[model samples]
Target chain A: MSIKGTDYYTIDELMAVCMARTIKNGDTIFNGVAVPLPFTAIMLAFKTHAPESIFWSGLLAGLNPDPPFLPPTSGDSVMLHRANPILHLHQIFDLAMRGELDRIFFSGAQIDKYGNLNNTLIGTLDNIKIKLPGGAGSSHIGCFAKNYTIWSIRHDAKVSSKGQRVFTFVESVDFVTTVGRRTSTRNRDELGLMGGGPDCVVTNLCTFDFDPLTDVMRLKTLHPGVTVEEVLENTGFEPVLSDTIVETPPPTKEEIALIREIDPMNTRKVGFSRSALEKRYDF
Target chain B: MGIHSSKDKVCSLSKAVSRIEDGSIIAVGGNLSAREPMAIIREMIRQGKCNMHSIGGAHGVDIDLLCAGGVLRRVQNSYVGFEADFGLAPNYRRMVQQKKVIPKDTDCVAVLMQLRASVYGLPFMPMKLVTGTNILDLHPEYIVMTCPYTGEKLSLLPAVKPDWAIIHAHKSDPKGNIKLHPPYFADLLAIEASQNSIVSVEEIVSEEEMDKIGATVPYYEVTAVVELPFGAHPTSCYPDYTYDRKHLAEYVKLANRGEDVFRKEYLEKYVFGVKSHDEYLELVGGHDALEELTKWNQGTEKWCELLGRNL
Candidate 1:
């Protein structure tokens, strides 16, 4: 596989920029804890394309944080320093229920082929081997927010595999912590859920969108240097491939600089450092 | 009617927390890392309150320490862990994983709605947030109701009026009226939704000052009021001080290492060892940290300047 901008940018920066462009102007985004990538991406988008965007900072109940330095975690109290009209966590959730929020960032340890997320347990409820953190607000945010997006840092055979915990993209999720495209409108109506299911799934290697008809996750774009064959090999479940798969746009210098500005502490970039990447995949 | 004397409501932390009986549902106030009634929580542990049901809006050290101290039998809240780099709430995680305490998972909205239902004297609060989520199935208590007017279906969270509610605030009057600086998470609702409410504040002000600050929770609703400075220590008392990151990090590390170690050393050293909040404060770096933290309590102008918001 051939790649571009190796010297200029890292894969994580490219992914952040790619995700950042999806944020439309004036969109209100709700981000949860441990959200370095989405936090930086939203900040980058706000600084560039979407200046009017409001970040519902759940960490400190902050609104539109204009912090001097990005805190390491979304839960950091420093996020409240520059916030205006500081909000309550419930107030942020109230915005979601009121259809005021445009998008929410959600993730799970396991994602099924149909975009269903499982974060409750890796094994049976009675007996659990690996108990992932329960859905903090993703369960509601996934259905209330106009749309939600899921991103993954470790995209490997085990993470993207088809079995239980052994393979993440299972035939059926252990638990549907977050509603996704798999639940049709009729089903959602029965459950009294509004809003569309997950619209996008961004990862280190590729980006996926729901199929128009089937609502299954389909390949939308691949990061530079990655291939369809590699994605297939890594995924546990079969994914629909686009006929003309486009390369994910590399982060421009300006966007990169803005991301750096938002994250002067280098929290997001540190995860994508060469040594970190090498340790992750043993490359 | 005009405000009356609030002398009877004032009490010590021990007296405030004594209202909490064993096996009672106790609602706590605070966001993830802000305004948690740590002094009250510590007192509860000191008093040997065990097997109490814990419910709150967003809980962190308060609930985690209670779980670690073997005080909580079950925890019902949206989330219970320390956020971001602080990682999981160790004792909460260990207990839940070990099934020592039942974990009743709910969202932040659902928890508030439940409290709202109680506050409004309603059986349930209609919400759209929990719809189509696994919580409905996991907890069958959440019912789906149809809006009589619009005929639209919505999720109904049952009213959760806990037996006792404990909260921390910046200031309060003897009448139990509390004043919060800003980002008053769900403290008011929590206090209102409980059978009895105990409030710990940094200072006791005159009723005029309480009214000036807009005391949200009226005196009639308060069961007890205690003046305890730095009531929210490990977690923040927003506008007063940010969370003690190093202390919280140490807790997460010790709690994660093993429950035995947590129970033996961490618990012994920080909680059981120190007889009071002042002792705990002194042990954790004393008046120097408090003096430094006092700068944050003044106002947001300095906070904004530190953040470089103008630029």
Candidate 2:
């Protein structure tokens, strides 16, 4: 499944890049509460390339649920496997530490250059308005996986434009799912690229990845029918752009089929972006 | 008393299966695949266990074998596997295709909520989660339940209260007070929902040690606890044992491939020949009698293989 040209990508398409580019076959991936990264990894692992990827989720089973892949949390029942989870959620730390995992799909309310993720405490701890989902297992596993793929659908002017994200009510969250940098911590070597941090951000409009050196997360590509300027206008953070910036690849018929056709339990609805999101394509 | 004699032990897995009559609600613990007591589950299928309503936990070999073999008539909660290789359980898909098993879909909280309510003795748990989305809406039976107190628009979710609760344990006393660390709560709740609970334990402690142990333990909750060493080898219970990957990988291949292999390999290899839990342990080891797992490898190697492929 290959995307073709210079265009903005859909959330699903960008999610594919997050799955494929960040993770390869057999990589043990840790998924946060609600992420498409592990979903993409598992689907691609099953259908296309990686046939033996290790998946970890919040669900106690640590196995992927059957079909059409609608994961509510990284550990939703969908990820459980009656036959094999290698280990369940209880064994996540053991496996990750042993270098058994290669990738992780996480959500960070705030992220920095070093790939440190903050999924909780957006504002001050004492007086909190919007209390996001408490960190299920994101804190420890986020830095442990080989590739950390971060995603959030609500990247618009309100959350993104500010130095600190304000929730539906937050003053500022200090971390994010993936920022473009590496940390000095020697504990996490499984994650490839030393730090291809945040590998990709799957938004309503496009998919994003950052430069290896500059530590700047730039708009990697736009979804079909979306312009570079359109992505920037909607983007909350200043992104690194190349003059010949490529357009986001289009979703393949097969990729489309994998998503549209055998969607697990018909859970894959046309997921909506944030209220602030302005996508170029209807999908 | 000795922790485990390794002799005169009854076949706990088979014993557990014997209690589960057809169509009875069975609550099986172990997350997704890990910590699941496959030995007992396989015995049920090999014995041609059928028409049973399987409840609780995530997808793992037990659900796979049952669904693939047509033993399961209905499936509640999540399963098949989280993702990656073999994506989902083939047998479950086939069951869905043949329209044999009913799929009860739910979110993590929903599944937890259902189980949580079941154990709590609440008639039903109220959820703010919008039901119009996905599998949550698929099974109105599981998603909605009437609040016994309110008598209002409470969605009636079935009490996961099972007829028998079968679980794999690391260590427990003969009296059935168990000690487990992180993964303890899920199993503890399972016991609360079921009428009678069976525990296949790794070590059966004396009253002294068992009394000294303090964890999630309720004497009233347990019915039977068998001391079966290496019982949860491949599946961890923490502070007690680590995952045995090789054994689990073998199960995964069979489960993903469907029931034929499961019947041949797992049922034949582990279940049929063993007369009891001690007999099964003897099957893994020999006359020397006792065997201890030092480190698990099959899983790490396979994980390496998976990591390489993902990279």
Q: lDDT per residue, candidate 1, B1-311, as tens digits? A: 11324566889877778878999888888766677888898889888999888776556788889998889998877677665456567788778889888877766667778888888889888887455556666679887777899898777788988888888888888777777776666776777788888889899998888777787668877788899888888777756776666677778888888988998878889879997788988988888876555565444444433322221
Clashes of each: 1, 73
Off by over 4 Å in 2: A1-283, B1-16, B142-158, B254-262, B277-293, B296-311
Candidate 1 structure lDDT:
0.74
| Model 2 Cα lDDT, one tens digit per residue, A111-204 | 4433345533344333333223333334334433445665554444454555753432112234232223444332122323222335555554
> Tens digit of lDDT per residue, candidate 1, span A101-144?
89877766788776778766666667655555567777777888
TM-score of predicted chain B, candidate 2: 0.77
Give the 10-residue window scoring lowest on summed lDDT in candidate 1 chain B: B302-311
List clashing residue pairs in candidate 1: A161-A167
**Native contacts retained, all candidates in order:** 0.46, 0.01
User: Which sections of candidate 1 miss by over 4 Å?
Assistant: A1-7, A59-61, A73-77, A158-168, A183-192, A269-283, B1-6, B129-131, B211-214, B294-311
Q: Looking at model 2 chain B, report the run of 10 residues with the lowest lDDT sum.
A: B302-311
TM-scores for every candidate against the unseen true structure: 0.88, 0.52
lDDT measured at residue A120 in model 2 versus the true structure, 0 to 100: 35
Tell me the docking grade of candidate 2. Answer: incorrect
